[model samples]
Target: MKDFNLSYGHWDLYHKALKDEQRHDEKVQEAIKNNLAHLLSEESIIMTNGEGMARLPVRSMDEYKLRYGSNDSSQVGQGDGSSAVGDTIGKLPAQSQGKGEGAGDQPGVNYYEANVSLDDIEAHLFKDLELPFLEKKENGNEGEVEEFIYRDIRKSGVMGNLDKKRTLFSAMKRNTIKGTPGIYPITRDDLRFKTWEDVRKPESRAVVFALMDTSGSMGAFEKYIARSFFFWMKRFLETKYASVKIIYIAHHTQARVCDEEEFFSKGESGGTICSSVYEKALEMIEESYSPKLYNLYPVHFSDGDNLSSDNNKCVELVKKLTALSTLFSYGEINPYYRQSTLMKVYEQIKNEKNRFFIFKDKQDIYPALKHFFSVKEKATS
Candidate 1:
């Protein structure tokens, strides 16, 4: 054993195996992409305690095993035992199905669980979505503010704005020009600093009004679907716009402004007054979020179980709101409440199909969201 000659072939094989494993993992993610709607649903989220990390059940690779082929058709116990067609040869213990306790040595079908973030789930859900009619409006001086933009570099500035690299380069150049070999002297002029210009930048701000009907008729399933839609909608808005203000309004018999937690979780028992919520949202918009200053989005979620009397009022309010809003989206979340009075009212007022959506189940959340945010290309004359 004087000298041991080791080849680097094992290293290449190891890296190749790692690449293959990564590819397999990517494929698994791609497979799970289609199931994002289910993953982002209320049921899946409730299982994870509303946490960001959700354990998603994924299909595992099929396990293969090499077996020896037998020449004889029947080998009874490797000897002389024959079994009937309906007779049980052996009994195998039942395996646990779900997230249960205890572990066993029994071999069974393998499954993979992927831990994915809510953001990732949203990204998948809203991958094809975009805010429509996001045209920049020239709102007077109210929208135009003096913003400090770093556009110019100067020889003089405050200590905080010193361009150290540029200053150093200037000092080095001056030193080189003066033929100073020993000392690297920095002159007053050589002290270059970054300068900022007070430019009047027009800021495009967006205000999202998330209205939900928390009436008595809205059961757990109804509330859950509404919450899921709002949650994803808020997340999608934040991702798309830099300056976005989200206002949550929850209504039962009466409409009231509430925080996100209260908006989604509060269980209010009363009659459904759909117009009240729209009125409150409109009032808020008129008072604070002006259409000229902000890109308004009035997104309402309901079970389509509003009072028959309130339908006309709701329609009128929606028309008024749509006049000011950049985009108005109304989502009806009841499967049984099909062709409902509230929906019928909305249909009459809706300018386009994408403006109004009917979500029957959790699977419809993604498509509804896409429909809400999608900008339809105007047909050329």
Candidate 2:
């Protein structure tokens, strides 16, 4: 190969282009953030092509060619065939309408599509929401958890626990003082071992009870709204809590504990008895999650339809749960179910305005989440 001197000017241009691309990507991300609520809606989630993958639409600037004027001023098209300055010379093609058919040669507005994972989307969605009253509970016992944490060093310990370098130095010093220099001479007093103290750490535990009214009144759209809310709620809680346990309870006239897959997918038909799920949730919390040990969060999603006779019982259960839980949130999914007995019953309850929410459509999901995460103020009589 012939001797050649490489020019670094192209490298500088490449770096500048890379920085411009990065800035453009950030602008696209900001655009996505502005439409985050719409992107997280039920329609968007359903339209996603893959699991945990979402297509985000971003507005992008179209590439334009810059025209430069000549240094010498001259009017070339000022002949008799040319049109006047104010008159239109030629007509541009009309823009296509919404989802129009047929392929056109004309350049269109740039719309960039970015594929983002659900985890990334959740990070943006739950940026400001934080769990309140997160306090360390009782100290947990330190067992043989197999965690190698250097606690302390001592003079006596097991052979495995011996600090080899320290022990060798001590032995060398002792040998020098006694004038008995040997290659591997080590006395019992010259041995220094590493000691470990039991580290008692406070465990911050939290449990979330996701209760859904799977009665016949809750249509597919209503269930979708509830499931979307729960999906975001679970993602947000996982980010906030160190230890989070989610219990999915579905109920019609009776309630039963189920897995998350079943909770969102399964459909049941029966009379709406809102108290059954609340009672089951309370029982599970008392048995498994102690109020003193775990911060409890009981979230109920319903269509606001409940038996008139069971409304009082539901209210009582909610009152008890609110007293035990760190936060109690109730989300009514159906807009037409406004005159529901359950909603009326909850309206009679005191000091739950911040926690209770009404979600009419997919648009209401963001507001409902804000309501759930909003700080509660003390209520006066």
On residues 1-381, what C-alpha lDDT tens digit does candidate 2 reach at each position? Answer: 257654322221123344355555676568667877776783545434215556666566444687787655532344467666787654432342333656755566666666656655666777777665555565552121223567777788888998988888888888878887643688788888888766544457778889998899899888888888887777787766556789999999999999977886778898998899989998998898888778788889999888888888888888988899888888898677456667777877776432777777787888788778656565666
**How much lDDT does candidate 1 score?**
0.74
State each model's CA lDDT, in order. Answer: 0.74, 0.73
- TM-scores for all candidates: the values are 0.67, 0.66
Stretches of candidate 1 above 4 Å error?
A: 1-17, 42-50, 61-110, 140-203, 379-381
Residue range 133-246, candidate 1, lDDT tens digits: 775766352344466889888987798999989888888777878887422677798887888878776657778889899899999888888888777777777766666789
Query: Candidate 2 regions off by >4 Å?
Result: 1-17, 42-52, 62-109, 138-203, 352-354, 374-381
Q: What local lDDT does model 1 show for residue 41?
A: 79
RMSD of 1: 11.4
Instruction: Report lDDT (Cα) of residue 218, candidate 1.
Output: 90
